[model samples]
Every structure is written in C-alpha cells, then in structure tokens.
Target chain A: MSDTLRPTDSQSPQPVQPLLARIKRRSFFMYAGATAGATALALAGCSKDETTPSSAATNVSFGTGDASVLNYAYALEQLEAAFYAKVAALTTSPLLAAEVPYFAKLATHEAIHRDFLRTAINRDFGGTIIPDLTPKFDSIDFTKRVKAATDTKLGILDAAKAFEDLGVAAYNGAAKLFKGSVYLGIAGQIVSVEARHAAYVRDLITPGSFATNEGTDVLGFDRQLTPTAVFAIAQTFVEQKLDASTIGQ
Target chain B: MNFFNIIDLLAEADPDVLDRFSSRRAVFNSLGTVAQRAALATSPLFLGALFQKAYAGTASLPTDILNYALTLELLEADFYRQFLAAGQIPAGAAFDAITVIKTHEDAHVAYLHDAVIKAGGTPVTGSSTAGIRFNPSLLPATYADQLKYAQVLEDTGVRAYKGRAAELIGTDLLTPVLQIHSIEARHAAHIRTMRGQQPWVSIGDDLAADANYKAAYTSGVASSTRTTVALGGTTYGIPAFNPAQPSPQESNLQQGAAGTKLALLITTGIGSTTYLPDDAAAAFDEPLQAAEVLDSSRAGGLLA
Candidate 1:
C-alpha cells in the first residue's frame, strides 16, 4: 500500500521496508517518511468537516493554531455582517434608491462571509469557536458621508469602506500564518473579493480613487495588518471583547 | 525511498530545480524541529503529490511560477502602454488614475523579472520567447472596447495569481504573490467601474461576445485548448486556458471543491424581498486554476 505513493517505481528501489528493520539508524528522511505515513492514516480516519454542536463562550478568545485564525476571521465577519445588516435595515437613512439596493447586496455578502466562517469553525474545531458577537455602531452616522477625516461619526459609505479595507489587509497579513494549504487557498479566494469590495467602496467615496497609494504601498502592494493590530481596530465597533493573543502561535 | 533520491529525480528533471529548492531551504529549516518532524510524519503520497505538482510539466518550478506571473504582468503592462500610446483615453483625474494603474503594472513587471533573476531562474520577458509577446492586434480598437478588454485582462490576471498561490506556499514568494493578487483585483474593479460595469463580477460578466469563448468568470485548467511556443529550441506550452471547474462560467454559485453555495438570503432576517441572482453571485468571486487562466486568456486572444 505504501508503494502507491512512490514517485516512480522504475527508478529507485524501495527503502522504506529496510528502514523499519533497522529502526535505530533512523535518519531525517526515514523519520519524515514514517510521520507522513502516520498522519495520512490519522487523517483518513477522521472527518474534521463533520458538523457538530459546539458550546459557545462569552469572552471570545481566538484560542490557538489555525482554529484561532478561523475564529478571528469569524469574529470580524460577525461584526461586518451586523454593521451591514443595520445599514441595510435602515428606512430613514438619506441613501439614494440605487444606493439602498447596493448596501443591501453588501449586507448579504457580509452575512454570507460570517456564516461561512461560523460553519467552517463549528465543523473543523467544534467547541473552540467563538460566540455570536454584538456590534456597536454609535460611531457611524449611517445618514451622511463624513465631511472630513476628523469627523468621529462615519457615513454609511465611509464605514463600509473602512470595514472592507480592514478585511482585505487582515486577510493579506493572515495568509502567511496559515499552516494548512486548504485554509490558505480559502483565504486567497476570499481576500480578492474583499479587495474588490474595497475598490468599489473607495471609488464610490472618491471618483477613480480605487487602489490609490494611500490604501496600498507606493509599489501597489495592498496593506497588511497583523492579527493583534487588526483586532485592536476591530474591537472599537464590537460590544463583545475579543482576545486574539494566542492566534497563529 | 531516501530523500536524496526524491531530490535527485527533481534535479535531473530540471537543472534549475535544485537552485529553486535551495532558495527555499532556509524557510523549511526555520519551520522548527517539531514542524520538521510533522513534515516527515505526513504521508508519502501527500509529499509525492507536493513534489510532483511543484515540478510537473515544463512550467513547474518556482521560477516557472514567477515567469508565469511575469508573462501576465508583461501582457498587462503592454496593454496599458498601448492604451496610452493611442492617445485615446481622456485627460484629467481619470487619466491620472489610469496612469497610476499603468505605472503599477510596469513596476510589477520590473520587480517580478528582477525577482526571477535573483532566484537564479531565467525571466520570460516576451523577448526571444515564442508566442509570449503581447498581440496588440487582439485588442479592441475603440476606447469603450479598450476599457472592457482591460477589465477582462485585469480580472483574468487576478484569478491567474490566485490559482497558483498554493504552489508558492512556505516561501517568501507567497506573500508577494498575494500582495500582487489583491492589487490585480483592485485593478479589475477599477477597470470594471470605468467600463460602466459593476465593481463585482456579476453573473453575466463574460468577456467574449461569441459563445465559443464564453468561459470568463469561473475558469480552470481544462477550460481552453493548450498551445505551445518554442524558445531556443525548447517548447513551452501555455497553461490550460479554460477554467476546469464543472461550470467555468461566472454565474457559478458553488465555491471550492466542496461545492459550498452562497445562500445567506436563506438565513432569517437576511432574505431580500426581491430575489436577485446576480447580487448573490457577485457577492463572492471564484478562483481559477493555472490552466483555466491560460485557457481564458487564449479565448480572449491574449494568449498565443
């Protein structure tokens, strides 16, 4: 069965069987090969994606490892989902008719992202998942675009832009921390979409300002923020406190 | 077998393969004693696949990945150069904004080429490389068509970078590639907006007006026909042009191999009174494989 993994049966003679006979002469290659075999067997026996009930916690600690990464993403998604839900639900905001539908779409996307991460965490890590977060939006006006950068209250467009940009930077920085290729692929898929959202919102705020030097580096690389830095900014809008000190450690 | 045998096979297959490995050896060494042990513990099948995928075909080196990216960057940089050379784009802020994008593409081409050389791999600069040159004849003549084609190019570049990102895992190459990936996406949105299209890729964002080249949105490895170009007597086949997913069209709602669909509206309090399929589809963008990106590029006449 182990022979099936061989790159070319015709080229090299099988060395795995002989290595087992002389376990005391364990080399790095032998050790690696043995571990790889065991991990494959272990993974084959388990299904991490099976949906299971998980007890949620109050003060969300992203915990440790990749699960912590997913939970951190989940917490941010929850905040964005809530923010957009509020914006979409508003009946008296001074939004244009076309703008209302646009916000509605944004709300759906953020909700979908939140739910996807929640399901992923629940299925993969089970009880390590964070609880639903309550959002605080008193700093956002949701009525009008902020006239200046110093304004404490952000307009709907300003808030959306901030959230979308934050998400892009967060994902960009976090991709390197992922140990699994699967999670990295998923992050790659999602980060571009977030960038698309950021571009759209940035353009809506200021014409043709998408991908400007301010949002990206002088060489056009997008901004990347570490988890600690991201959560620091993100916590301001969330009613629930988030602890991501253990993430990706 | 022994680790030497596996590496020997890779080196024998491609002379530059060992150099690429050496460049990344430091990263693997720093994975720490425990992680190294875990790497050994992984199944031989898994490790075999990793090596094979990293070295398969003529395009399977870290240098190949960089060259592939350089090819796309060259194509984009040339496209903008032509757009500006034609004296067609209107002046003022829009022009300046486009100049920003154009300069970035130029910078990307330069940086990627330098990185390729620094990594001890030959950069594919469309010079002396057969069928790698930008075919301006394939581009649309009118300004509107120009912007639309630009949108297609930018979006295709976005997916192309994403499709091969996993291949670059555990190296310094990964972050830089992702940085460029997001930048390409930003360009896609900016071009889409300039074309009077939605910032997001909606259901009908297909580039080809003809049905034969319809796989624009959700393309993969087997989506288009493969064609080879000769450089210095060596034949290099452009990666698959069509996205290989079951449905390569942008209208696809299922994401990833698990086929997870976006159904946020089904959740309570989030349902829209008016059902809009495009909005749901547009809310999320799909990923393409390297072959799929090549296929889509050929369908658009960007690839030889």
Candidate 2:
C-alpha cells in the first residue's frame, strides 16, 4: 500500500529496510521455535515491539514549524492506516460479518488521510517531511473484537476506538499550531470526520455511548490533548519515537 | 416565545447572516466613536440582535467573532430544547442520546457566553420565543423528521465552526472551537447512525434529495469583499483559494489546492479497496461561510 504495509514516502529504501527486517525477524523466530501450522499464533505471541531493540534508536524528529504539525498528523495517519489494513486483511476476523463494511470504509479513509498528508507535506515542505513510520500493531489481536481487561493485547474494536479518539484530539490540539489558514481549514475538515468515525465505532461498542468520556471532557467539551501527550500514547503503537517539540512554533 | 428563540428568528430572517458583518460592517465601521458613547445614540433600531450580539459588552473589546459564534450556539441550544419538548423522539437509547447532545450544546452556550463576557464584551442575551424562528410544523409530524433535522443542524454546526476557525487561530479560542466542532460531528454521526445512514458525509449523503433541506447541502464562501479578519490586535487574511470555484459543497472530491487534489485521492491499494471520488468527498468536510450559514431551506426554513 502507498500509505502503509510498506514505505512509499519521500525517503525510499531507508524506511523500507527496517520494516522488512522486523517482519523477517518474526518469521525466523516462528519457524525456528514453533511448528509451521502455528504461524498465526507464533506471529501474534512473539512479534511484540519489545523484541525490536533497535526501535528506541529509530526516533524520528518531525522538524520544526508547520512541518512538525503535518508530520505529527502523518505519523498518526500512518499508524491508523496500517492498523485498519491488517484488520481488513484478517483471515480469521472475530469482528461481526455486518461490521466488516465499516472497517473497510475506515481503512480507505485512514489511507486517504495518511497519503494526503504525505502529498501535502512533500509538496509544501519538500525534503523536510518525516520518514515513513513503521506501525507496531503487535499488541492488537485481529481475531478478537474486544479483549478482556487483563489482556495485554487489544481487540479490533478497542484499537479502532483508541486510534479514532486519539486522532480527533490530536487534530484539535495541533490545528491552531498551523500558521496558514488553508492548512488549519483542512485540519478542521479532517478532524470532524475523524470524530464521526469515532462516534460510530463507540456506538458499535456500546449502544448509546457515542461521544462519551473517551471522546468528550467533563464540561461536555471534546477531548483536546496536546501533541506531547498524544505522542506519548502514539509512541507505544509505533516503532519510531516521535518528538513533537516546536510544532507550530 | 422562549428567551433563545428570538436569535433563531433573526437567523431565519437573513440567510447570509453569518458569524454577519456585511450589513453591520458599514454600521460598525461608522462607530469609531462608539467607545466614547452609547450604542443606542449611534446605531439604528433594525440592528437589534447583531448590534448587541457584536458590540454587546463594550466598544473597546474586539469580540464580533466570538459574538457570532455565541449567536449560533444559542440558536442550536434552543432548537434542541424545543425539539426535546415536542415528544417526537423515541424513548430509551434514542431519547437518552439526543438528551446527551442537548446537554453538551447547553454547556457550549454557557461556556461561549462566559468567554464573550470574559473578553470584556457583553454577551448577547437570549430573547423571548414569541417571535421565534424554526418552524416545527413543516415536517411530516414524525420522529424521522426530527432526527433528520437534528442531523442537518449538527452537520451545520461542524461546518459553521470550521468556517470561522481560522479567524480565531491567533487567539486562545481556536482549540475550544475545534473541540466543539468535532463534538458536533459526533452528534451528527450518531443521529445519522440512528437513521441507518453512513456515519460520515458522503456524495450520496444528500440532504437535498427531499428538496426541503436543500440549504443543508448548499455551498457558500466568504465574499472577496470581506476577506480580511481582525483578531487579537492583528489583521489576518485568508490564503489564496480559487475565486472561480469558491467553497465546495459536501460532495466535492477536490481538497486543498487543485494541484494537490489528485495526490489526496491516493488509494494505495489497501485490502483491495480502490477509493473513488465519493470516498475522497467523505474523507473531508468543507467549510460554510459564516455569512451564508442560514438559508431558506436549511436552518432558516425551520425558523417560524
């Protein structure tokens, strides 16, 4: 995919190299220790981000000013696009048959967001765009719709909700950082659509819980987390550590 | 008439009345000395809601933008209140959910009101419902009509905030406006879900198919004459957009600049999904001019 599953960013072979290595390492581990028939379980169990010690060294700086903000959004969209792609590609998806269409829609929407940001950033800032991010969805179980509280890995819906809600807050807090009105306007356009996605996913999880606490704050205001706070949560799901310092400054 | 209904009445009276400085611009421009005297001594009587709404508390404070925002919030909040009272919504989940939305809207009204007053400007007061707008009798007297209207209002809320958000970018109010904007989208999505429609805006998501709700999908943008906006002691202007095309409607697949529209539509082969023009349209929600928010078929048509 242009947006995910591979690196098609401004940086060519560099971004692709690490991602390929990560998957290859997991493949070797599964074949050497586990049997051939247990491939799915082996990949899920042994492919956690912790196994990749090189991840911490792969920290990405999103650059300064509007470049940083655009990169911040691009990084998130990358993670989301990758996650939904895996979900949609699931051979043994635990998600309901009726709910499959929603994931498909989410997959395309996220890819569009990711690719659009890439196109915009590369067009506007040229060489300053960040390298393609490697999404670490090892902690998500595509075979489960919702996981137990004690489970380390999340189900499909849990991860979707988290990504959508995180996306909404991220845009709200970062949009004002943009100096240009057109960019800010575009950010507004995308964030509301993200909110819509979040609400629909929330309803799927709980009948009438759309736009609840996870989406809105106490005063009925929607959640607006700063980039620093957002990056903290995002760093857990991605192989790269993103530093949002000086964004929109 | 309830206290807030008067705001809707005026919104219905002038479809181009935005978050509106056009009619009030020449009037406000002449009030260079309003800071030195009473608004009543200088302004005419016809400028009622907007006059006080824009120049409510004091003349020295710059709060026309915030006042415009407050005007919309008050209108939506009152509409929800009246709709809840009409008993058209189903009980259990549907009623509970709409009530939750109404609560958030009311909270927005309170917060925006205080924000205006805190900026050293008088907050616009709500008026009686006697001469209120938002005609409730035009529908088929059904719950589906109620939900559809709510969907239109919520989507409009999202677009309205997006339209004026750039004006408040330099100020501290941008995030709050954005935060509220998303919440409105959430409300829109939930209502659309109840109606069994796609959660996000799509090309087929036509509110105008019924003909009566034509204004909901109608397009408008800030006029070239009103391009510059003043905020926080600095004047900010909109970036260059095609005057030939202006603001695109909900069904528009083109985003950002024309040069980048194709790039934004990149499908990239994710799970055999080739995104069409409609997906591009649904991915982004365009802004509606604050000057052209209400129209005969949109929110204005509901005005009594």
- On lDDT, the leading prediction is 2
TM-score of chain A of each: 0.73, 0.77
In model 2, state the lDDT of residue B196: 88
lDDT of 1 by residue, A109-226 (tens): 7776776677666656788877677787888887775436767788888888889989988988888777655567767877888898889888888887788777336586888889
Superposed on the true chain A, the predicted chain A of model 1 yields a TM-score of 0.73
In the range B123-236, model 2's lDDT, one tens digit per residue, is 554532533324546544678887788888888888888877876756798888788889899999999999888999887775656676666776753333343433223332
True contacts kept of each: 0.56, 0.79
Q: How much lDDT does candidate 1 score?
A: 0.67
Accuracy of chain B in candidate 2 (TM-score): 0.66
- Please compute DockQ, using alpha carbons, for every candidate against the native two-chain complex: 0.24, 0.34
Candidate 1 all-Cα RMSD: 16.0
iRMSD for every model: 5.7, 6.5
**lDDT by residue for model 1 (B167-226), tens:** 776678888888888988999988887776667787665454535345565444443355
